[model samples]
Target: MTEDLTFNSKMAAVYEKNTRISIPTYNSLFAMIQSYYRVQLGEKAASLLLIGAGGGNELSAWGPSNPGWTFTGVDPSEEMLKIAKHKVVELGLESRVSLIQGTTDDLPKTHLKFDAASCILVLHFIDDVQEKLKLLGSIKDKLKSGAPFILVSAYGNHDESELQARLNVWKSFWIDAGRESSEVDEMVRSAITRLSLLPEKQIEELLAESGFMKITRFYSTGLFAGWICHTE
Candidate 1:
């Protein structure tokens, strides 16, 4: 989690592979999100903020289908954004997609309100409760009221028994999914010790305090969940 928001060359190269091995239903979850946005936005020419848009996955998934929609993909990792940029170019979406190498706070304050936003698998890296709220608040500030925001991250009850049970199952899933034992052990250790996973209820409370409402969980597997929230 120390480098979850930013990635080195080696980590970036293996991210797609390792993520598939570790996170169950990784591609399917993205597909569901794409469907949700497309159905919700219709033919409207909307702008989207892809907070922590690493590897350009969101742009690649959402752009070609919604040709009218534009995206501002922000991330702290230059290496990750490099791939996203190349993907945008390859998809010939350079005209509609803007890539920025910075955190959400570094985004230019614009009168242009986003029609929707997504912060996926990003915020848990910031363990500080206040910082997490601040980050969500920043994203909320950019969105128009009633705009849907998709947020997905690892979260769980912190009880020792619950965490241990889930951790063991998660570790086995990774190992069974072809990850080597050493790598699985290391990842499980990091998840247990380094990652800050607040309970689901606490996460929802923070979101509500950050000005999101009608939070709906659409996907969940292992301790990870995805939600569609509205700024109200």
Candidate 2:
């Protein structure tokens, strides 16, 4: 499977719409994450390190609501980061949001540590298990102790009947959202070629190994699942 999941200019332009269509609960998931963070940090000022922050959806969803929060968003795709930068400017969040066109590994070494972090819809793109762990570990290294972290990813044992059922439901969602059957089929086929799925049990294990604790799954929609945890 190819691990290069970065979007081209054409794909980046329609990312938001396509994401909303493919994941029916996209807004709900963002809302829940924002709510969780608000409840945890309260009125205190906080910094968030957003992994795969390319599309700017997280900033669009969380920035206005949490005036005390600042963001350092990193993504590997230049095209996607362009969209994020555009959103930051359009939302008047330029002062609070920094968009970086690279991975966490590219972030400069510093004493700065974030209050919390999130990796949304990004992990499954990495086909190598160790690379996934490394990314998680890098996020952990940038966070303060006990910092809350959210991980959302597409995961399942493809051989399992339950996963197959969820996949069918997911495909139906795309169809219902106005994607042509052939387009949906092609999308699914493309996703399968790039997606790296793990069972929930394995994901939890990865969290543990990455120095995160108190792992709790907070949301599930179709084939996508989200977990909220804290740094050790």
**Superposition TM-score, candidate 1 onto the true structure:** 0.89
Best candidate (score: lDDT): 2
Off by over 4 Å in 1: 1-13
Q: Please, what is the whole-model Cα lDDT of each candidate in the order they appear?
A: 0.83, 0.88
**What's the lDDT for candidate 2?**
0.88
Please give, for residues 74-116, the per-residue lDDT of candidate 2 as tens digits: 9988878877876787689989998888999888787399999
> Could you tell me which residue pairs clash in candidate 2?
none
TM-score for all models, in order of appearance: 0.89, 0.92
What clash count does candidate 2 reach? Answer: 0
lDDT of 1 by residue, 127-197 (tens): 79999999999999999889999999888866658767777777888878777889878876766568878
Lowest summed lDDT across 10 adjacent residues in model 2 is found at: 1-10
Model 2 spans with C-alpha error above 4 angstroms: 1-13
